[model samples]
Target: MEKGIIFDIRHFSTHDGPGIRTTVFFKGCPLRCIWCHNPESQKLEPEAINRTKKLDGQEFEVKEILGRYISTDEVIKEIETQVSIFDESNGGVTFSGGEPLMQPRFLLELLKRCREHDIHTAVDTCGFAAPELFRSILPYTNLFLYDLKIIKSDKHKYYTAQPNEIILNNLSMLNQLGASVMVRVPLIPGITDDEENLLAIKEIVKGNNSIKRLDLLPYHHMAKDKYRRLNLPFELEDLEAYKNERLKEIELMFSDLEMPISIGG
Candidate 1:
C-alpha cells in the first residue's frame, strides 16, 4: 500500500499533454519559484485553508483542506475510470508536481501501474532530481514536460531557491539517452523572459532531435486569487499576463527550430 500526497487530480486537461488527459498533481517540491501558480501544492502535508464563498450578495467564510495521502490502488482506480476517455482521445495520465520526483518510490509505483494498464504516461518535472531518479522512471514515461527556467546559475539560484546544476545535468543526461522531452519555459515577465535567458535556452536545445517541441508559457496573474485564499502573498501581483503580439515575437525567436513551438503550457 504505497501512498503519496496529492493536491489535485484534474480531468479533461488539454494543456498538460497530448489530447484530453488527467493531470495528477503530486504535492511537495524542491524549488520554490516565486511565481508558483499552485502555491498550495508547495507543501507536502495536508493544509487547512480559510476561503470565502458568496451566495447572492452575502459573503461567507469556509474551510478547505488541500493535500492528502492516497494509496496507489486508490489513485489507479481514479485513473482507470478515465481510461475510456483516454482511449478515445489518445490521452492518458500525466504525473505533475511540486516535482513528482520528490516522492520517488510512490511515483515509480504509479508509473509502473500506468504502464501495466497500457496507458500513455507523461511526467511534468522541474528536472531537479537525482540523475538516477530520471533513469529509473525513463522506461515507464512516454513523454516528459520538462521545465527549464533561468539558465544562468546565479539567477536560477536566486529565483528558484535551488541551484540549476542538478537540473541541467539531469536534462543533459536525458538528451544523451534520447528521451522524449518537451522543454517548457515559464516566461516570467522580467526574470525568465529576458532576451539573454531566452537565447541561452535556445542554445541548449539547438541540435537535439530527441527534444520534441518547445512550449513558451507566458506568466499570468490568475493565481493571485488563489494566493489570497491561502493567505499567501502574491509576489507578482502587479505583473500582467503577456499580450498576444509580444508572445508572437517571442515565438518567432524559435521559428527556425526543427521542433514545433507552441505559445502555451
Candidate 2:
C-alpha cells in the first residue's frame, strides 16, 4: 500500500482538461517557476500556511495546513464517488501537481486504478521527468496537458530554476510515442509571451504530428495572495496580466501551424 502526499484535490475542474475533472494536485515539484500560482504545492511535505482574514470588523489569523498523505485506495474511492459524473460528461481524473511525475510510483498506481474502472484519464505535467517514468504511464493516460514555458535553455533555467533540455526531450519523445498531448503555454508577460520565445515554441511544434492542440494561458495575479499566506515572495508582483489584444496577437502567430489554437487553458 503506497501513499503519496497531495496538496489539493480540485473537483469539477474544467480548465485542466476535457469535460469535468477531479485534478489531484500532487505535492512536490522539480522546477521553481517564479510565477507559479500554487506555491503551497511546491514542497513535498505538508506545510502550515498562516493566513489572516477580516470578518465583520475584526481581522482574525489562522493557520491552515496544506497537503495530505493518502494511499492509492483512498484516492480511488474518492474518484469512484464521481464516477457517475465522469460518465455523464466524458470526464474522469486528472493528475496534476507541483508535478505528478515527482511521485511516479504513486501516480502509476492511481492511473492503473483509473484504467481498471474504465475512467478517462489525463496527466497535467511540466514534462520534466525521466523518460522511463513517463513511458511507464503512457498506456494508462488518455490525454496529456503538457506545459511548455520558455523554449530557450538559458532563459528557462533563469525563470524556472531548471533547464529546458529534459522538458523538451520528454515532449519530443511523447510525440514519437504517438501520445495524445495538448501543448499548454503559460503566457507570462515579457518572459514566455515575447515574440522570440513564441517563435521558438513554434519551431518545436511545427512538425509534431502527435500534438493534438495548443493552448495559450495568460498570466494572472491570483497567486499574489497565495504567496502572502505562504510567506513567499511574489516575483511577478509588478507585472500585469496579458491583455486580450496581446493574447490575440500571439494566437495568430500559431495560425500558420495549421493546428487548433485556443486562448486560456
Candidate 3:
C-alpha cells in the first residue's frame, strides 16, 4: 500500500474551497512563509515529542506516533460519513497542504480515487512547484486555490525564501492552459497587506480571466501558540493583523474586475 504524510484531515471545512469540503493537509513545504498558521504542516517531520505533551499532557523525548492516512477504499467510506453533509452543503474534497504538490505522486493517486467517485476536487497550492508537477495534476483537478504572495522578487524571497519567478511562470501557464483557478492572497499585515504589494498582485493577476475571483485571507497571530509548542520561533512575530475594513478597502482596487472579490478564505 502506498502512503502519504498528511498532518490533518479537516471535515466540514468550507473556507478551503467551494461548497462543504474535507481538507486533506499534507506535510512539507518548500517556502517559509513567516505568517503560516499551520507551522507543523511545513515540516516533513511528525509532531515532536515536546509538542505531544501539550496536546495530551504527557512528556517524552521523541514521539513517533503514527498518523492517519486512510486507505484508498476507506477514503470513500469516511467521506460518506459526511456525504449527506456535502450534498446539502454543495461541497466535496479539497487537497490542501504545506503544499499538496510537494507530494505529487501520492496526491495524484488520491485525487484519482476521489474523481472515480465523482467527488469535486480542489487543490490549494503555493504555485511554487515544478512546472511538470502542475502539468501532471491539472487534469485531475476541478478547481485550484492558487496562492500568490509578494510580486517583487526580492520581497517575495525575503518573506517566503523563494523568488517569484517560478511562481509567476506556473500561474501564467495554468491560466493559458484554461484551468479553473481562484487566486488566494494571504493579507499578512506588515508583509502582504502593503498597498504596493497588494497593487502588484492586482496587476499581476488582473488580466487572467481564468483566475477572476479573489479571496483575501486576513493574517492573524494564532500560529504563534503553535510555534511555541513546537519550540519554533515565528518570524512574523509582533506583526499586526490587517483589519477587516482595511481588507475591504484593498479589495476595491480589483473592483473593476469582472469577478467578485470576497474577504476571508
Best by lDDT: 1
The TM-score, computed over Cα atoms with residue i paired to residue i, of candidate 1 is 0.97
State the displacement of the C-alpha of residue 230, model 1, in Å, after optimal TM-score superposition. 2.2
Candidate 3 to native Cα RMSD, angstroms: 2.8
* Per-residue lDDT of candidate 1, residues 36-117 (tens digit): 9888888888889888777998978789998999999999999999999999999999999888999999999999999999
Can you write out model 3's per-residue Cα lDDT over 97-188, one digit (the tens) per residue?
88988888888887887787778889999999999998998888999999988999998999898998998999999989999999999888
Which regions of candidate 1 deviate over 4 angstroms?
none
What is the lDDT for 160 in model 2?
93
Could you estimate the TM-score for every candidate?
Answer: 0.97, 0.97, 0.90
Model 1 residue 258 lDDT? 87
lDDT of each: 0.90, 0.90, 0.81
lDDT of 2 by residue, 31-146 (tens): 99999988887889998877777689997778888899999999999889999998898898999999999999999999999999999999999999999998999999999999
Q: Which residues of candidate 2, in runs, are more than 4 Å off?
A: none
Q: Higher lDDT: candidate 1 or 3?
A: 1
Order of quality (lDDT): 1, 2, 3
- Give the range where candidate 2 is weakest over 10 consecutive residues by summed lDDT: 223-232
RMSD of each: 1.1, 1.2, 2.8
Q: For model 2, what is the error of residue 263's alpha carbon versus the real structure, in angstroms, after optimal superposition?
A: 1.1
Q: lDDT at 161 for candidate 2?
A: 93
